[model samples]
Each structure stands twice: as C-alpha cells, then as structure tokens.
Target: MANYFVGDIQGCYDELMQLLSKVDFNPSRDQLWAVGDLVARGPGSLPTLKYFQQLDGAANVSLGNHDLHLMAVHAKVKRANPKDKLEALLDSSEINSLIGWLRHQPLHQELPEHKIIMSHAGVPPQWDLNTLRAESLRVTQALQSADYVENLLTKMYTSGSNQWHLEMGELEKRIYCINALTRMRFLHSDGRLDFECKVSPAECKDPDLTPWFALEGKVNQSHTLVFGHWAAVMGEVSSTRIKALDTGCCWGEYLTLWHLEKDEKITQNKLKKS
Candidate 1:
C-alpha cells in the first residue's frame, strides 16, 4: 500500500478529493498523512473534518496552528478569526467530537519503514528527531488533560520570537514546543524561532533570517523530514532530506500530495469560480 502525504489542506475539500482521486486512494489499504491545517481559510471546513474524522485510523495528522486555534475558539479561549471560515464546522453538531479528535492528534508522526518524519512545521534547528517526538508527546498528553482548553490554549497565541530557555517553566516549554511544531518558519541568526516573517526565502530581505532546514548544523538528518504550514515556500527547500509540501491551495494555488515511497509529487489546482 502506498503512503500519500498531503500538504496543508486548510478547508479545501474538493481539491483534497481531486488529489486523492488522482492517486486512487483506498482507505482499507493506503495510508494518508496530513501535514496539518486540516481546517480553516477555505469553504469546506465541516465536510473536511467529517471526511478525515470518519476515516479514523486510515488517516493521520500532525496538528497545525490553525487546528490548534480551532480548539481555542471552540473553548472560548480566543475569538475566532472570521477570515478562517470556520463557522460551518463550529455550527455542526459533530463539532465537539471533531474537536476532540483534532485535539488528541499528535504534533509529530514517524514512518520508520520509509525513514521519514512529519510535522506541521519543520522541526526546530536546536533539536533532533527524538526531542521532537518527546516534545510532541508532551503536547499530546497535555491535550488529553481535562484543563487543556482553559489552561494551555489560552496561553499559546502570542506572536514574535518563541526563544527556548533552560529555565523556562513547564507551560513555557509546552508553548515553545507547540510553536516549533505548528507555527515555525524561519530562525534568526541566533537560532531563535522567528514568527514574524511569512514571505518566501527569495523574497525575504533579511540576510540573517534562514529557513529552519537551511540552518548550519541543525536537524539530525537521520531521516527525511516532511513539513508544510509555510505555503510561500512553494514546495522548495535547500536541503534534499527536507521537503516542503504546502503549495498554497487555500490561496487559489495547487494542492500538493507527496508519494512517500516513490518520492513523487502530484498536485491538483483549486477549482476556479464558475
């Protein structure tokens, strides 16, 4: 059975279906891995959540920033950004169950047979794959806790640098790990996470800013890393072992799907307005 890894879906259900159809996905056999952002910013949040939630074990996801934001919005920890287009999903009766499933989804996933690691955002330049897995497990366990909504979600929405520290508290470390896995894009010259820049590398004027995968002496490189969340990259990375999968489908660009075993990329463009 083939393993297909999809880029940030946001809420583009039709595009997702078209890409899956292109690969002739079979839930009984093939496995689907989502780089995350499974909801928000498109027109099909509810349908998209139902589609994957029902799939259960057939599909796996690494939680993205938007997914975590959806949880916060549901719990009244933060106000929903209307631009995210999440109302339909929030209005559904299954919203609660869907949110539960999403909350429990891990921050990282491994396909050891293929020697690949997947996260919504690239792994931090400071840590190896083992650290990623451990931090991800911490967030996952926190999510499973009874007070996650009020306790953790309320504290994770800040912007700017999420610099790590040895003296950081448990909550601070959790937030750092969450941002590293879900919101990271570039690192400052000092190797600190920079959340401000959203432009592609070529367009970025700051010479000190470097994509996480491009940092010198970063990442363990024991396995290939697959990540999304930064649509501006247009699926380009300086490292051969690290792949960017998001092609900006939610922004009217092509949706990308990676064939893990074949090392192939298949794409489907967004449907134009009729």
Candidate 2:
C-alpha cells in the first residue's frame, strides 16, 4: 500500500478524482493524506466531503482555515464568507454529521516511520515535534468539546498577530496555537504572525516580514514537513525539509499529489473554472 499526500482540494472534486485515478488510489489499500482546505471556493463542497467520508480509515486530513471556517459557519458562530461557495454544503441534510467529523479532525499528523509531519499551514518555527503534537492535541480537544463554538471558534476569528505570552489567558493561548497551526504564513522577525501579506516571497514588499519556513535558524531538518496553505507560493519554499503541496488548485492551477514513499509527485489540471 502506498501513501499519497494531496494539496488543498478546495471543493475541486473532479480534479481530486482525476488525481486519485492518476495515482491509482484504492480506498481499501492506499492511504490518502490531505493537507486540508477540503471544502470552499469551488463547486463541490458537499460532494468532496462525502467522497472523503467514504474513504473511512484510508484518509486523513489536517484541518485548514477554510475547513475550520465551515465548522464555525455551521455552528452559527461565524457568518459564511460570500466567496467561499459553501451554501450547498450548509444546506445539506448531512451537514451536522459532516461538520462534526471535521471538528474532530486533528490539526497535525505525524508519520514517525517516514520522519514526516503534516499540517495545513506548516508547523510553527518555535515548536519541536513533541510540542507540535501536544499543541495540536490541545486544539483538537478544544474543537471537539461541548462548548467549541463559544470557547474556541468564536475566539479564533481575530486578525493580525497572535503572539503567545505567559501573561495571556488560556483562551488567548489556544487561539494563538490554532492560528499558528492553521492560518500562519508570514511571521515577523520577532515571531509575531503577519497575516496581512499573502504574496509570493519575491512580491512581498515588507522588509520585516518573512515566510515562516524561511525564518533564520528555524529549519527543522529532523523530519520532512508537508503543508498546503500559502497558495501564492505555488509549493515553493527555501527549506529542503518542508514540502508545500498547495499548487493553487482552486485558483485554476494544478492539484498536486505527493507519493510519500517514492518522494514523487503526480499532478492534475483544474477540471473547471472557479
């Protein structure tokens, strides 16, 4: 059995299917790891969720920002973004079950045998593998708890820097961990998150801001990290340890699938306009 790691599907179900076919994926045998943003911006959120659910034990996903937003919208803690095209999913009869499954999904997944870890936005520069695992579990438990809508999702919607400090409250710390694992891209030299910049490295105008993976002395060569956010980079980063799989599939780009054991990639072109 092989392991295939895919980028942000973003509801591009046709592309996802084509890519899986290219890889000759067998739900009963092959394992599929999605780096998240599974639903949103494209045309098939409900169908995409159904497809993944059918995979059962064969598929694993690291929850992305869009994925969390969908759960928040479903729980009535946040309004749906006008451009995400999530109405069909929200209106589905299985919305409750689908959202419940999504909430229980982990923020980080480690493949110790492969020396790899997967997350939506990439692991924080400050966290070691053990710390990453603990923080991920903490957030997953919070999201799966009875008061998730009020305790976690509601408090996690703030924009700008999410720097953690000892003086901050527990809720603030949780929110910071959530942002670091799911929404992080650029970070200031001082380790504060820079949410304003979404451009590729060459296009970024800010001198103080740096891509999280490029931060000096922050590379963790101990394991290969796979992530899917920062589509603007189109799966490019300075570090050899970090592999970016989001090739902007939702933006009329290709959907990337990584063959983990072989360290090879298979890509499928966008099958429809977003």
Per residue, candidate 1 scores C-alpha lDDT tens digits across 178-244 of 9998988889888788878999988989888988877753454577889999999999887778889
Instruction: Mark the regions of model 2 whose C-alpha exceeds 4 Å error after superposition.
Output: 159-161, 216-219
Q: Looking at model 1, which ten-residue stretch has the lowest summed lDDT?
A: 213-222
User: With candidate 2 superimposed using the best TM-score fit, by how many Å does residue 235's alpha carbon deviate from the native?
Assistant: 1.1
Best by TM-score: 1
Per-residue lDDT tens digits for candidate 2, residues 1-274, read 9999999999999999999988789988899999989999988899999988878899899999999989888878888887899989999999998988898789988787988889999877877766677678888999889988888888788654388565766677677878988888998878898788999989999999988888542326688889998899998877778889999988989999999889898999988544
Checking candidate 2 for backbone clashes, the offending pairs are none
Per-model TM against the reference:
0.96, 0.95
| Candidate 2 positional error at 63, Å | 0.3
